[model samples]
Target: LTIVCIVGGGPAGFYTAQHLVKTRPDVQVDIYERLPVPFGLVRFGVAPDHPEVKNVMNTFTQTAQHARCSFHGNVSVGKDVTVQELQEAYHAVVLSYGAEGNRTLGVPGEDLAGVHSAKDFVGWYNGLPTNRDLRPDLRCETAVILGQGNVALDVARILLSPVDILKNTDITQPALDTLAESSVRRVLIVGRRGPLQLACTIKELREMVNLPGTRPEMEASDFECIAKMLKVLPRPRKRLTELLLKVAVETPEETELERRNSAKRAWGFRFFRSPVEILPSDDLTRAAGIRLAVNRLEGEGEDVWAVTTGEVEDVECGLVISSIGYKSLPIDPAVPFDPRKHIIPNTMGRVQKCAGLYCSGWVKRGPTGVIATTMNDSFDTARTLLHDMDEGTLDISTVKPGSAGVTTILEKRGVKPVLFSDWEKIDSEESKRGEGRGKPREKLLDVGEMLKVAWT
Candidate 1:
């Protein structure tokens, strides 16, 4: 039997495992997750209210329960067992550890109390233990998000969403409480380019437009040349552009009237602005505002780039969330990583010059695309591994020990791997707890608490 070890229990890892198991009857797969829980981003990055996206978790759960598959959670790859160690024990090693690091804006005053990365903020509300203590101060009336991605819109919607609406979701109790007390009423989502260059999709944008008791604030000039180019763009981009134009231009009179009457909450887009620095308060301890350098588009369509106009403007707000993007982290010294691309050096899922080793998802490519894209990428990697095995390029003739060998090594090191059944126990407890609060499930945000519950 060929023993395959996949690092990371995210969508990429699970999808790869699923494809491998379905294709090869003689293959046994073991998934290693650093967290006690499985479903990486689905559990900690997706918005609470967007339960539809989390539906993918049901499919992942099915993969984990496969008879030929095994899940080893709370197992840190680099610390507990190195990549070389796994490669030796298994016939093949696949690195699907999705990007855990967030790209930072290299600007002054970024370390201020009110500034946070969208990754951390999302983790905080979604019950990731690492960010449980991120007690962001939402006492200010205005909040500024420094990107136009779906993540930026998620933050905006969460901040402006009604407390009653959030209470029904599986959002952390602490986060729900803090949001209920949030004084923020206005959110300004700023980007370096115009509406045509927005990173968010139409689904999220439409949700923002229809958010209850909230109004959209857009500058009419932002959509000046948008309509003329709408017919020339692709279907998705054209539809998105048309929506923006309708919101910013077609309904100007109605929107103005709604803005005058609606006093609940408001959000707006500030285009052609790039962050120069996060302004500090009088005492220099917290963020008071942000300094932005105005920008202009240099070209048309998708090739457009932002050019600084040399004019700086300051927008007063106490909170700033940077939703720039995510980057992959170097797994171990044994694995080859391209620091420049922030990905494992791979060609068609095969690690460059490294036989019997592969990578997929964000670690194979940069952080972009939706779930469908990741699933397809992972499937390709699994196919590559299978091709190598069929062609005798990967030698599995030496009868490897598989999970039993790794279990003995882990036992000697005093590491307790959480099994799929063990996670089910934790999952059950979380669901029971959520029942008391009328939500889906209230996650245990501490590792100790999670293990204790699982062990119980």
Candidate 2:
């Protein structure tokens, strides 16, 4: 029997596990997750309001239910249990930990108050354990976000949504309640690149514009700013613009009709030009807004967009969040690292220097694509693993990973990995808490609060 131990219980891991069982029922698979539960990005990466985009969980759960598979939660690969030990315990091991770190803005004032990373802010709202306590006090009258992706749109919408719509979402209680109490009225989403070069997918773009109850204010000046950027781009960028423009043309009608019935104010979703410096808040200690230098396309070859000369100016705002991108952080030492790409150097899914050991998802291919693409990536890795398993090609099992002391250490140290059952209780309690407030399930942001909730 082929016993496979899969690390990282995200889409890639689950999909690879599913394929192994489906293709070879004789293969017994055990999935180890660092978190107490499954679903990596879907659980913590996606925006809470976007429950539809998160429907991928259903498919992942069904796969995990297979008779040949079992998931061990609260178990880490590198720290708690190393890959070498898993290899010894199982015939083969697959590493599917996706890109785990937030790509930084790489500028000063990133540590300032009211300055938030899209990952930290989004993860906080989405209930990621590490970021659950992150509360940005976005109630400022104006907020600035750097990036032009769906994430930026989500932040903009969340900033501008009526307290009512926000009350019903899966947003953590701290975030939901804070925003409901926030005085923030305006948001500016800044992008370094031209509008045509924006990294958002069309499906994600529509959800922002056509949110259920709110129509965000789009200033004519902002559209003109974006239009200037769009005019300079090549083919697909123009096409994307035409489509977004059509959406804009139809927005006033949507707002007019929605206003006839609902009390929800329009949600403003605007894109600002390149960002130069994050201006401090009116008080100077907190972020006031951003100092932007208008960018112009310069490089005749590679679509280089840079700040032009003497076009610097400031826009007043309260909070700043950078929704730039994601990068993979090196975890497993066995896999060779490429600092440039933040991914393991590999062909398809095979790690270059190491044999048998391989990577998939963001770690192998760099951070890109959605949940579906993660599945496709893992399938490719699984095939390669199977081929290598048959040949007994690479062997690097020198230091065995031991889980014997893990449970004891966690128990003695008072570290409880939120198990699936623990998560269920947390889920129920959050819902009950929300119901108490006449809102949807509100999350407990603090780790102490979460642990207490789990215990109770």
Candidate 3:
């Protein structure tokens, strides 16, 4: 029997295992995750209000429960075990550990009290154990988010959505309580490019436009030349641009106008502006505002780049969340990592200069695309691995003790691996707790509590 090991229990890992087990009946796959509970971003990164996007978890659950596959949680690969060690126990090792590092704005005052990365901010509300104590002060009147992606929109919607709307979601109790007392009335989503080059999809933009009790405060000038160029763009880009035009340029009908006029909260897009520095509050401890450098597009269409016009603008805001992007961190000194790209250097998911090693998802390519994109990417990697095996590139002739060997190593180190059954126990407890609170699930935001429940 051929044994394969996959690091990380996120979508990439699950999808790769699903393909391998279904395609090759003799292949046994084991997934190792750092967290006691499985489902990394699906459980931690997805916004509470967007539960529909998280339905992918059901598919992941099916993969984990497969007879030929196994899940080992609470096992930190680089720490509890090394990449080189897993290679010895399994015929092949696939690294699907999704990006966990966040890119910084690289500006002054970024270290201020009110400045937070969207990765941690999202984690705080989604019940990621590490960020449970991110007690962000929502007492300010305005918040500045530096990015124009779907994540940036998710953050804005969560901040401005009515408490009644969010009460039913899986948002943490602490986040819900803080949001209830929030004084924030406006949010500015700043981007370096024009509307034509927006990174967000139409669905996210539509939600913002239709967000209850909130009105769009877009600048009319931002969409001046956008309409004339819409017909020549791709269908998706054209549709997205049309929506932006409707929100920023076109006048709404009477009923819609009334809704806009009566909105209690507001959000706007600040296009062609790049963050230069985070302005500090008096006493110089916390973020008071942000200084933005005005930018102009250098090229036409979606291939445009932002060039600073040397004009500066300052907006007063209490909180700043940078949704720039997520980067993958190096797992171990043994693996090859491209620090500049923040990804494992690989071709077609095959790790460069390393035999029997592969990678997929964000760690293979830079962090981009949606869940569907990740699915296709992971399947490609699985196909490549199978191709290598059939072509005699991967030696599966020798009998290797997969999890049994890893278990022995882990036992000596005193690290208890949480098996799939153990995770179900924790899952059951979280669901039972959520039932009391009228949510789908109230996650255990403490590793110790998760392990206690898992082992119980």
Candidate 4:
């Protein structure tokens, strides 16, 4: 049997397994994940209010239930077992463990109390086990988010959204309680680029614009030249820019004007600004505001860079979240990694200088694109592996014990793998808990609780 082991239970891992099993009937796929629960970012990073995006989990569940596919959760690749060991036990090893590290703003006072990376903040609200204790200080009225990506918009939306809206979602009770009493009414999403160069898609921008109780307070000046540029831009970008123009430049219609006037909260984009420092509060224990260096775009079209103008401005706010991006960390000593790019160095998902070792998703490419992009990228990797096997580049003639061999190693180390069936038990328990709260699922924020439910 051609036994393949994938080290991650996220979208990339499951997508790769789905392709592997469907293409070759003899291939038995095993997925090992660090968390007892499956679906990585879908569970821990996506905003609770966006349930439709979470529907992809159902497809992953179907993949896990395949007779030739097995899921082993609660197993850390580098700690509970090593990559080298998995390579020995399987005909091929695919590392899909996604980007878990955050890219910092590299500014002073970044370690201040009210300063948080968007990853941890998203995790806190989404019931990620590690970030459950992150009780962010929401006593202040204004929150400054440093980035203009979709994640930045998500953070702004969650902070300014009405408590009643979020309470109905699967957001944890503690987070719901904290948000209910939040005094924050203003959110500024700062970026170092112009509207034409925004990283966020139009859908996220539309959601932010239509967010209840909040009005767009964007600078009219930013959209001044954008009108002439729209005709030459791509269709997707043109539509997004037109929307921005309507909100930021053109005079609103009667109904829209009334909505803006009546909004109780406000959100806006601060373009051509880059964070210089996170200013400390009076006691110097937490963030008070952020010092931004004013910038100007140096080039035309998408090939532009922010150039500092030697002028800086400070906006007073209580909380500062850096939503720059995510970085992939080295999972094991044996796997070749590029420290600068924060990704595994690979050619079409084949790890350089290492046979039978491959990677996909964020760890192969950088953390970019949506779930569909990840699916296509993972399929390419699986195809690459299959090509290698057919070309005699990978020797699959010898028997590899796959999960059976890995289980023996894990047993020796006193680490019990949570099987796919066990995860279903945890899922059922969570669903039952959610039924009491009138939500889809009330997530168990504690890993121990998840393990207990699974074992029971």
Best by lDDT: 3
Model 4, position 26, has a per-residue lDDT of 75
Cα deviation at 133, candidate 2, in Å, is: 2.3
Q: State the lDDT of candidate 2 residue by residue for 10-76, as single tens digits.
A: 8888888888888876577777788765788887777776778778877777776788786666677
- Candidate 2 whole-model C-alpha lDDT, 0 to 1: 0.70
lDDT of 4 at 254: 95
Candidate scoring better on lDDT of 1 and 3 = 3
* Per-residue lDDT of model 4, residues 306-417, tens digit only: 9999999999999999999999999899999999999999999999999999999999999998999999999999999999988989889898878878899999999999
TM-score for each candidate, following the candidate numbering: 0.98, 0.83, 0.99, 0.99
Which regions of candidate 4 fall more than 4 Å away from where they truly are? none
Model 1 lDDT per residue over 1-456, tens place: 999999999999999999999988999999999999999898998899999999999999998999999999999999999888898899999999999999999999999999999999999999999999999999999999999999999999999998998998999999999999999999999999999899899999999987887887788877787788877899999898888887777745775666636758989999999999999999999999999999999987799999999999999999999999999999798898999989999989999988899998889998987888999999999999999999999888898888888889899999999999999999999999999999999999999999998788
Where is the poorest 10-residue window by lDDT in model 1?
Answer: 251-260
Give one digit per residue, the lDDT tens place, for model 3 in 1-456: 889999999989999999999999989999999999888888898889889989998898899999999999999999999999999999999999999999999999999999999999999999998899999999899999999999999999999999999998999988999999999999999999999999999999999999999999998888887889978999999999989998888889999999999999999999999999999989998999999999999986667899999999999999999999999999899999999999999999999999999998889998888888999999999999999999999999999999999999999999999999999999899889899989988888899999999998
Q: Weakest 10 consecutive residues, lDDT, candidate 4?
A: 397-406
> Which scores greater on lDDT, model 1 or model 2?
1
Candidate number that wins on TM-score, 2 or 4: 4
Q: Residue 373 in model 3: shift from native, Å?
A: 0.6
Q: What's the CA error at residue 33 for candidate 3, in Å? A: 0.4
